[model samples]
Target: MTTILVTGGTGTLGRLVTERLRADGHEVRVLSRHSRPYAVDLRAGGAGLDAALAGVETVVHCASTPRGGDEQAARNLLAAAGRAGVDHLVYISIVGVDRVPFGYYRAKFAVERLVEESGLGWTVLRATQFHDLVVTLFEGLSKPPVMAVPAGVADQPVEVGEVAERLAELALSAPAGRVPDMAGPEVRPLDSLARAFLRATGRRRPVLRVPLLGKAYRAFREGGHLAPERAVGKVGFEEYLARRFGPDGGR
Candidate 1:
């Protein structure tokens, strides 16, 4: 069995990836800021990172923060991986990092570059937004009496479990740089998704579409973040809601 290290191993996607790898008989190291044994902080130049990489053949980098510092974390990881002689480095990124002008997307794109030029065997998979993120967005939007959503914006929300499964598969295989994007089964409007959340939560609110200023908003409105052709994910938003909230809307 191969020895693999999964950064952010306690996170939503990382947790699943770690589980799959361990279940497949691979020795998995879970690295996080708070996780024991391998609790190294990547953002702080990843002290104690080299120890975690010892005998690790592969690495699945799932640790990222939308709040910032992702680029530094990636650089630290790449440096440590190179020093540890890691055979493969796998990264998960967003599909529209190139097309979208958002700050978080820009950081993700930067990390992608770092992985590519690190001189280590690497693979990168760009996926559409996860269902959990969409749910979080909707939960915040539904808080007010009138839910405000971006006008003409749509999201393709993929299942986190499916992404984790794919990452596990890639970790076991040879490094293939920049694979095809993974997207949800449908490209749905933001307002529609908000409505779905409202239905599932048994909440009634008027969904209002608001046109915001800036290039990033325009990019989103123009579908810069969608992957229509790569709609390979099996779970749709409605089905996800059904499973999460139950048939009776969890009422």
Candidate 2:
């Protein structure tokens, strides 16, 4: 069995990936800031990272912060992986990172570049936004009396479990650089998704579609973050909501 290390093993996607790898009979190590035995802070030069990488054949880099510090973490991981002689480095990225002008997307795109040129065997999978993220956004927007959503924006929210499954499969196979984009079954508008959340949560709120002025919003409106051609995901947002909130809108 291959020895694999998952960087954000406790996170939404990383946790599932780690479980999948271990279920497949591979030795899996979880490395997080607070995880035991290998609790190394990846953002700050990743001290003690060498110990974590020792004897590791593959690394699934799922540790990322939307606030900042992703590029630094990636650099530290790459350096450590190189020193440890890691066979493969798998990275997960967002689909619209290159097309969107958002700061977080820009940072993700930078990490993608680092993985490509790290001189190690690597694979990168760019997926659409996860359902959980969409739910979080809707939750935040729904807090106020009127939910204001960006006008004309659309998203294909893929299942995190499906993404984790794919990552596990990739980790076991040879490194194939930049595999096909994984997207949800439907390309849904933001307002529609917001409405779906309202229905699921049993909340009544007026949804406002405001046309925000920005390149990032423009890209979102133009569907830069969507992959209609690569809609390989089986689960849709409504089904996800049903599973998460139950039938009858979880009331």
The residue pairs in collision within model 2 are: none
The sequence of per-residue lDDT tens digits that candidate 2 reaches over residues 105-204 is 9999999999999999999999999999999999999999999999988889999999999999999999999999999999988999999999999999
Candidate 1 residue-wise lDDT, 147-204, digit = tens: 9999999999999999999999999999999999999999999999999999998999
What's the CA RMSD for each of the models? 0.8, 0.9
> Which residue pairs clash within candidate 1?
none
What TM-score does prediction 2 earn? 0.98
lDDT (Cα atoms) of all candidates against the true structure: 0.95, 0.94
Clash counts for the predictions, in order? 0, 0
